[model samples]
Target: MLKLLNQLLGLFCCFLMTACSSVPKLESNAIAPIVKLPNNHEELGVMSAYSDPWEGFNRRMYYFNAKADEYVILPVVAGYQKITPDVVERSVHNFFSNLDEISTFINSLLQLKLFVAGETLARFTLNSTLGLAGLFDVATQIGLAEQNEDFGQTLGYWGVDAGPYLVLPLLGPSSLRDATALAFDNLVFQQAINELGLDTDEELLISLIDGVDARASLPFRYYASGSAFEYEHLKLLYKKYREIQVAR
Candidate 1:
């Protein structure tokens, strides 16, 4: 048991180092600050207006994530990209995306966005069957565009305040509301996997593949933003992005 626990910790630490939130009234000021760059672009007063109450812990986590990404996750991702054919990679992405539509559909319904829910349902149905288990995104070709909805957004839609900007280990940026939402989503996902009769080993394999695939798809690199205050900028971006998502 101890050996297994250590292995899991090591694996999570590897992920934590590789990458890199939120909220009150779901307001911008509560979670992040508006970053203003002067004409010379040399001065940034981001921290002065920033609302990262957990700045000490958050910055430490960010530093750890960046270093891990540089040494571990990025290399693994690069290797995966190198060995996998483009077409194959896209199919893997599509397959997972089709699975994600299930969560999105449910969240959309919870948020009372019936149209989006229906659309996601159609996308899932079409892609699962005609798209050959989502190896292809046939739904998008016909105008059933993919919609991004999650439990966090559902919470935001229901007026749950983002508790604070939180940097989650291994998972990266999130707010209190979003983090709770994430736990709920994970429970739902695990239940679905169980319903599908996936064994524990099979489930773990799929999760690793999903994580690798996700990392490959993301173009963002830690510390690559060329800013001394990358943490502040990332915080602001995440906050603003969630704001838009919740508003939508």
Candidate 2:
């Protein structure tokens, strides 16, 4: 049962990572200042340079995650999409995203990003009340855009190195530091859920429903990117994306 719960949790994270898989185009002028890779960079050399000491384990886990997603998760998501009204799905997304703002606000405060912290606090308050428990994104409409922050970014701000690339059984691409942060964030979220007076069964039901809604909204399909080197690309993209997030 514990294993099943962890796998269910993975669907949510997998959707999140794969949904944002598009690599941002770096300006040619900015590359020198940022990455500082050699002018004569070789594709193979760069790919090989990506640190993945646990590649053997990671590859096996990645295969398991992909298969679980293809067989179990996507079918449920498909069924959910077929039955649920579009507006209801959007509300579910908004509601979960609003709950996430709590963690984002806390992490922002930890990183001492007072402006982001303030914005997140205001956004949560406005959305919870004016947006009707975040069924609507009133904050974004009113120019209070959501700020994305996490404990991983907070650790990064304090100069914590992304230790090593890791592929969790269902969770997808992460690093030692980020994985630890993920666990921490989940614990904090569970505590918040408890404070909201939800019983264990209610929390579990919400999680499963959230996973379905999340996977339904994302367009990513495992092994569908059409790149022969999909694994390598995924690793690089995730790393670079996290770097960009931390930089911001």
Candidate 3:
């Protein structure tokens, strides 16, 4: 249930970001700065030079994945207008709150002092049960506030630094550290899901679809900003945003 809720909430957040923004003219020049291969360009360059076949394969797969994401997932979500920007925003907030409680729980078990876990269990439980499965704001009434965390933040907490920025083929922009964190998080999640007896291929498929849906639901408020440099603008904004998240 938590997984599904998270997926939906994630899609809502993505949709909000995409839908709220106006499409600006795509400018090749705008890409120059953001895409300028960084100092560690050597890392990616080495991969390409020494492992041309693998790099090519990865690039193809990435492009296919991005195409699938934009063409297949985005439209399905665009059809779900009833979700609404307001509801998506609120659900996102509540979802984060619930996760904060869960993170607290995890941190407690892991002996991490970075965050308090499990204190919000009562609130989460109540909200999940009485608040119509976390679609409402019941948890807020009791002051069990929401805190958001992701694999990137987890990595930062463990002292991993964000290494050079890289635009992943289909995954989009992420740093080396953030990408590694993503993989680690997936592994952990897979193990947990397996332990819960819900890690079948079908289950995984549903989860992926849920994730895409969640992303698609986010309003693209910035897209329509009437900026000629939309792509670069978003790229810069997201880089800073992710960095802040990692720092936190």
TM values, all candidates? 0.79, 0.81, 0.55
**Ranking by TM-score, best first?**
2, 1, 3
lDDT by residue (122-220, candidate 1, tens digit) is: 999999999998899999999999988889889999999877898877567778888888877777667766766888899998888877887777666
- Local error of candidate 1 at 119, Å? 0.3
Model 3 segments more than 4 A misplaced:
1-70, 80-115, 118-123, 128-137, 199-202, 221-226
Residue 39 CA displacement from its true place in model 3, Å: 20
CA lDDT scores, all candidates in order = 0.75, 0.77, 0.52
Question: What TM-score, to 2 decimals, does candidate 1 have?
Answer: 0.79
Model 3 RMSD in angstroms:
9.6
Candidate closest to the true structure, highest lDDT: 2
Candidate 2 per-residue lDDT over residues 38-122, each given as its tens digit: 5445533545556899999988998898899999988888888889899988898898888888999999999899999999999
- Please estimate how well model 3 matches the true structure, expressed as its whole-model Cα lDDT: 0.52
lDDT per residue, candidate 3, 1-248, as tens digits? 22322333344345334432322355976654565545655454312222222335544554565576568656666664445576775675555444345544554444454334454566668877878756677867878665555566666767777665544654554556777766655555555445446647866764564454455545443235464444434444445565565565
Backbone atom clashes (below 3 Å) for every candidate: 7, 0, 33
Candidate 2 least-lDDT 10 residues: 1-10
Question: Candidate order by lDDT, highest to lowest?
Answer: 2, 1, 3
